[model samples]
Target: MNGTRLRPATFKYIESELYAYPDYQREINKIRDEIINGQEEQDENIGAGKNSYRKPGRPTERTVTRLDDNKRMNHLKEMVHVVEQVYDRLDDTQKKMIQLRYWSKRGANWEYIAEECFISRRTAFNYRKEIVGAIASKLGMN
Candidate 1:
C-alpha cells in the first residue's frame, strides 16, 4: 500500500482500540524503547522504494533525523486528551464499561469486560459498538 493509503484496519484500531495496553501507555513504552535502542537502522535503498528519498549528507551518505519519536509521543498525548474528554461526557454505566474494558490490565479482555459490566457477551458487543460510535463522534475521530 501507499504511504497515505487509508486501510480498514486503521478505523478498526481507532474504533475498537488495537492495543492490549492502556491508552497512551503503549506509546509511552514505545518512546522509552526507542530511547534505549538508539537510532533506527538506515534504509540503505533510499531512492529504490516506491517514493524517492534524497540523501542528506554527502551525495553517497544517507542521514535520517529521528523526529517521528517526538511526533508519535505528541499524537499519543492528543489522543489521550480526546479520549478523556469523551470519557467524561459518558454516563456512569458507559464509564464503567470503559474502565472494565480498557483500564485494568487483567479486566481488559472481552470476556472479562462482559462479566464486569453485568451483561451478556452479545449485549456487551452491541454496547461497545454504540460506545465507540459516541466516542468517535465526540472526538471527530474514526
Candidate 2:
C-alpha cells in the first residue's frame, strides 16, 4: 500500500491520471460519439460505391488498423478501466476517500478527508496508497 512496488514516475503518473479521470471519461465519450458519427457518414458514402471495392457493410483492414492505432483513445480507455476496477473493489469509506482526494472541487487535504470519513489522517493516507497501488498494479506499472 506504500506504492513502493511502482517506480516514482509511474506512481506520479497514476496519481495524475486519477485526478484527471472525469476529464478522461468525457474525452472518451466525445471521441466515441465522433467515431460513430464518422462511421455513419462513411457508410452513406460507401453505399454510393463511387470509390468501390470496400463493400457496403464491412470495415476495411485499414480502417480497423487506424482505430487500433489510436493511442490516445486506447490509453484513456485503459486508464478509465483500471480506475473503475480499483474503485469497484473499494468499500464505501475508501470510495469516499477517492472522491474527497481526487474529485473534490476544493481539493481536500488528508486532514479534511480523514475528518469527513471519520478516520485518522494516517488512515486517509493509507487508503490513498491502497487505491494508487491497485491502479498501478492493474496498469502493469509495478
Candidate 3:
C-alpha cells in the first residue's frame, strides 16, 4: 500500500489497541524513549570513535534515525484520534473481536476467538472478516 493510506491504518490500529488499556500507553512511551535514547547514545559513541578520516573531509554520516519532539507528538496525537474514532463506532461484539485479535499481546487466531466467544471457528472467521471490512469502511481505509 502507499504511504498515505498505510499510515492512517497503522495509526488507527495502534491507537485502538493502545487505548484499550491505559497502562499500555505508559509502557509504549517508556519503550519508545528508551529506544530513542539508546540510539542517540550509540550515535554519540560512533562519532567519538571515528577519527581516521580523509583530510579536511565533511563529517561522517550518521546511521541513527531521529525525529524532533514536535513531529513525534503530533503523530501520537493523530494516532490517538484515529483510534478513538474507530473504538467509538464499534459494537460490543466488534470491539471484543478487535481486542482479542489485536490488543491482546498473545495474538489470538479465529479458532481462539471463536472458542472464547463460544462460536464455531467458521463463524469466528466470518465475524473477523466482516469486522475488519466494517472498520476499513468506517475509516475510509483500504
> Would you list the C-alpha lDDT of every candidate in the order shown?
0.60, 0.79, 0.55
**Clashing pairs counted in every model:** 0, 0, 0
Q: What TM-score goes with each of the models?
A: 0.49, 0.76, 0.45
Q: Give Cα distance to truth, residue 9, candidate 2, Å.
A: 2.1
Identify the candidate with maximal TM-score.
2
> Model 2 over residues 52-115: C-alpha lDDT tens digits?
6555454455456556777888999898888998999999999988988897744777888899
- Pick out the ten consecutive residues of candidate 1 with the lowest summed lDDT: 59-68
Which lDDT tens digits does candidate 1 get at residues 7-125?
45554665545233265776766775665566645667846865776455542121223434477766676677667776777777667777766665544777777787777888777
Model 1, runs deviating above 4 Å: 1-8, 15-69, 105-111
Let me know the TM-score candidate 1 reaches against the reference structure: 0.49
The 10-residue segment of model 3 with minimum total lDDT is 57-66
lDDT of 1: 0.60
